[model samples]
Target chain A: MTVIEDALFDLAEHLDHPGGEELEATVLRRINEPAPFDASPRSRVRTWLAVAAVVVVIAGALVAIAPARRAIADWLGIGAVEVRRVDRPLPNGPSTHTVPGSLGPTSPAVDEGLQIATAQRRVRFTIAVPRDPTAGTRSGVEVDSRTPGGLVVLRYPRFTLVEIASQGDVPVVGKLVAPGEHVDPATVGGAPGFWVAGAHQVTYLDRSGRVRTDTVRRSGPVLVWVAGGVTYRIEGLDRVTAARIAASVH
Target chain B: MHTMDRRSDAELVSGARQGDLDAFAVLVGRYRVSALRVAYGIAGSEAEDAVQDAFVKAFRKLEGFRTDAAFRPWLFTIVANESRNRRRSSSRRTKLDLQVRDQPQSAGAAVDDLVAQRDQRRRLLDVVASLPDRYREVVALRYFAGLSESETAAALSCPSGTAKSRLSRALNMLRAQLGEEVTL
Candidate 1:
């Protein structure tokens, strides 16, 4: 190896391996379990029939009404905001569902439930908190200081939570709002933000770019916005409430 | 256990393709550290999940893997692709840092030498981290993962010539960044 190659390997030796038996067990468990989409032969046939019935009905509706086609086409637009209105009520059950790409190991735990000031001191970047009293109490704050651009999550417990970090600190991939979730554009304290309403599947890529399946399936609405070179995700509130809470962040 | 360890990756991969979980588990055990390293180099904080996803995906698609092919490059390709997808989707780029805590300490004259070595390593890491995504990745695969040129090319899904050129370019960029700090 050349001098540069030798140096590269030497540097690589300093990286933390962090291996554990638990990781292996998790992989084994996941592979052994039946796939989420798998079902019995009879159930498969019934599902296909149900799907066919729905398709026929939708086709008849499209054929009967020309405006429906236009609406469908408009819904499939590739712009920032694409709207699709559902005629029927959304399924009712557990508000949270674990989508295929939803699970992954939790972010490295910082000292949880720290006071805002203490949490801020622990991280490199400034931590922004919602200034609104009605935004609820600051129940907890956690900081992951492992990276140069640290990650701070502020929790208001049941009311709402805000995750704040520098632009490049966290590698966020996949749709912020999963398929079948409703998303609309709104302003957070006059800055542009996305108001995602209803329970949605959130998929995040692990550092290696693999879909993470370890995150708890979040229920309820959220507001995602960026301000002052920081990305903020406010969760557990209605669209208007979430936006209002986001606006109050300082 | 020793026999399992002795089995080539291809043999294990063949067994894995036939629904042999033991074979797959052995493979995972063998490469998990290497996978984690490559993942960290590519995806940073998302390394754990990325490695898990890559392994699962590899298992699900094992039937498609050619028997004659080397397993490491093929697996690394999945990992690299996943990392790239993550980089694109998140629009967040992270540079890996060498931590002092992971290094061993020394005494007396060796202590000074160790300190200098650590500093050099840190500087080199910083320079590599500053490199553009493409160059950084080639370096990570070629140097960090210790893949041969042709294997790196296969992992990258590029021609051997292209891989060689990229490696040369990446090395030159690293040298430029390092300047007179270290001789290439």
Candidate 2:
């Protein structure tokens, strides 16, 4: 681990933002004042990002969409995504129903709620698929992909995907879960805790480069599984983009 | 457990959204340091300006906040963006006064060395200033400021994956830029 990581964990154990209430009062006053979108902070950055994205997109769409490529052309690793579409359609896959399992984590008040472990793993993965840009589909893919990658505990999650062969020359990995069809166990937590076996846990291989045995549990999307911790989510982007994102995980 | 009494972020935001200055104060109290750090990292020249601008913008647009969302990320989004803008417009550099290395009243400890370390951080900030805006933002957030992947994503208004990817690339760039002066 780098000094930053070590120091961060150490700091997490001792997170105390010490200061003055006068500052908070000042902040409160500022937030309540009226402002326009163009005059807002988000608009300014969006304007810059939009300009940059437009400029970069024409010359390097492949790289522009590739999240990690921008960071790691000579970054930590050689992140390459080959999301090629296969002419031969993929075979039929299993199906499942998903709803907004937004009940956060199981109650800490309940003694039998999700039991959490304290071990940490260096998480890494590559998401290599793109869903429609609709809010629902995009949200689902992004949340699910990134969920298990960060610090959180996982419960039983099921995924049934029909292989999506790319029309263009790109290598797609992992079966793409269908629209409105989500993996079973939803994510949980905001703290730095790892899921023992989370719902719809996105499995990652270890140092040995072998797909680890995935553990899926039996409860539905009950906060009962999350153990009241912070769960990070990863949504799926285009296949090429997914690969880039995955490769960037240190 | 504190969960029962601890109100949800949505609840807090709702109260703040209604012009409950106290509730908004709570939200601000909850996030000021992180917000300040984001501003300080990006707009050290006018870090305070970036911070004030972000808080003002957030309050002004309180009604637009989606009720179900968490406040930290939303607040961070405003702060992060403002930091970027401040950086572009403000040329003033942050003069970070190093915390005093309160050493034990012993003779063997190299207290001078600790002071040197402080200077190293100050120099490190200079090195950081030399980096591109994107890389600088990521380094400040991820390492110095200490934001999580999701938090950073919320602040940047980008996806978590995008945040991580950018952070990784940025860190690598920093490592390359500072060479041996700064270690990851």
Candidate 3:
């Protein structure tokens, strides 16, 4: 190998990445073993046996079930934003303060004000801006770093574009759409996307994994899509207009 | 039965296919770090979850494994796919800030040389990060994860020639960015 090629490999050795100490145990536990919870001996043995049997059964059933799980996760989840068809939407009101310093009912207004460049620097993923003049005239841009992959809110005259990063398996934003709500599969920028119209519950998963219900805005429709490792949600626009604005994002 | 820890991957895979969880656990213990590294290369901070999911998925799909094929590459392909899928579904909140570990100073090594080496390493990392995803992935799988060219191709779900060309392109791009002097 050339010196540069060798250097590349040598550099990789020193680059700090996560250690795999817990990984083997975690993977094994998920696949086979039951959780070693503290319990009375008699019950523990029963529980162990029961859970072991269940694990065996589940292990065998996983062949049939794993694909179904992937399909469901794929269908309802658009990267960071997941849309669940719930039996009933949360009471149509602004979200109450459930946790200390949790996001209250108000949506985009909660972010600390910052310049667009500063916000861009603070985030790992690229911040896409709509090129369309109608949606491009940004009123403000704010950064909320409370989530793993920070959240950026770009306010326009007619719509709000909220970008959240999906850095892990955890769902960053969860939307509960009721039976009557309009939830349709969409294609934006040649990538799969979703369009949700009408009232819905928008919950934000905080850094600590707490669910913070964002206020339900009955104002207009919302366009959600995952492109280039970021979930983009545009609210307050019709489907065609939202698609156009989403396409203009670069 | 043969001792589980020292058994070849093929042996463990065969045992695991026959419903031996211990054999699979041994395999998990062996490949967890490599899988995590490959996953992190693609999925960033989400590598842990992606790796865990990949292993579970691999376990479920072990029935389809070809007896003669290498296991690590097959497993890595799943890791790469799991990471990519999760990455596609997720967006970033935190930047992937990779740091170099502090190395013990060599006996009588010049301070200036050490500083220069550190600077070069940092520049190399920056350039690698800036490369397009395709090129970046090849560098990651081949050099970072230490996969062989064929292994990299298998993990990428591409032909060996494609992997070879991509790695060459990636190296050329790296050399172009870092300049030829660094190579010497």
lDDT of each: 0.60, 0.41, 0.64
Top model number, TM-score: 1
lDDT of 3 by residue, A44-118 (tens): 233122212101111010111122222223343322323233343345554553221123443332455577899
* Model 3 lDDT per residue over B1-184, tens place: 2223789999999998766778888888887767777666666777789888888778867767898999988998888888878777777733344556667789999988887888778778878777776787788788887999999999898999999999999899988888865742
lDDT of 2 at B28: 66
Q: What is the DockQ of each candidate?
A: 0.25, 0.11, 0.27
Q: Which portions of model 2 show Cα errors greater than 4 Å? A: A4-21, A29-250, B1-6, B91-109, B182-184
Q: Is the docking of candidate 1 incorrect, acceptable, medium or high quality?
A: acceptable
- The DockQ leader among the candidates is 3
Model 3 misplaced regions, further than 4 Å: A33-250, B1-4, B93-96, B104-112, B181-184
lDDT of 1 by residue, A1-250 (tens): 7888877776666765444556666677666542312111223233222211111111110111212212222323311322333354323344243332222233333456678788778666578878888876777676655333555767675454544443332233223233455567666666555666666444332222233323325446666766665556776777667767777788
Error of 2 at B13 (Å): 0.8
Error of 3 at A221 (Å): 44
Instruction: Give the TM-score of each candidate.
Output: 0.51, 0.42, 0.48
Q: Candidate 2 or 3, higher TM-score?
A: 3
- Of candidate 1 chain A, the 10-residue stretch with the lowest lDDT total is A53-62
Per-residue alpha-carbon lDDT of candidate 2 for residues B1-184, written as tens digits (9 for 90 to 100)? 1123366677777876654666666666666666666566666646667777677667656767887787777777778888788777655544322122233445775878756554555455555567777866776676555777787777777788998898888667656666776532
